[model samples]
Target: SQTIHQWPATLVQPVGSPLSLECTVEGTSNPNLYWYRQAAGRGLQLLFYSVGIGQISSEVPQNLSASRPQDRQFILSSKKLLLSDSGFYLCAWSGLADTQYFGPGTRLTVL
Candidate 1:
């Protein structure tokens, strides 16, 4: 069965702190990976996405970046955090069928 994993389920950081979130998929190869941020009670916003390793596309211009180092591994990073960055971060992957399966997501709170 295919599965997705995300780390640091919840986070609390002061303003200007560095942030890193990881997501990986099992039982799949070269799937399309995506990063999304959702504000409380708001719709999901696409942050970044990758069709293949080292091929990343940004949908929103913000303080965050994403990298795909491996076929099934995607990483999201920020040099510094902002108060507006507080939200739910979700990692998802889709196979050839283009059906996205989301990970458990990380909740970020910036003070």
Candidate 2:
């Protein structure tokens, strides 16, 4: 059985600070990892995705970036945070099929 884990669970940050969020998947090999953000009352927005180690694709231009350091680990980072960046962050993984398994997610509040 595969499981996805996201850290911090929740975060409160001031504007202009740095940010780092991590996601890891267990019992999977070379899975396609994804990072998504969901704003209040809005749909899920695809932020970044990785097909393999070091191969990342960005769906939108925002104040965020993602990296896949290992086959099962993905990290989302920001050099400087913004008030508009506050939202629910999700990490998901998928294999050959279309079904994606999601993590518990991290809710960020920037003030």
Q: In terms of lDDT, which candidate is strongest?
A: 2
Report the C-alpha lDDT of model 1 over 29-106, residue by residue, as the tens digit: 989999999999999999999999999999979999999988999999999999999999999999999789999999
Task: Give each model's clash number.
Answer: 0, 0
* lDDT (10s digit) by residue, model 2, range 1-111: 999999989999999999999999999899999999999999999999999999999999999999999999999999999999999999999999989999999999999
Candidate 2 has its poorest 10 consecutive residues by lDDT at 93-102
Question: How high is the lDDT of residue 94 in model 2?
Answer: 99
Candidate 1: stretches off by over 4 Å:
none
Say what the RMSD of model 1 is: 0.6
Off by over 4 Å in 2: none
Could you list the CA RMSD of all candidates, in the order they appear?
0.6, 0.5
Candidate 2 yields a Cα-based lDDT of: 0.97
Q: For model 1, which pairs clash?
A: none
lDDT of each: 0.95, 0.97
TM-score list, all predictions: 0.98, 0.98
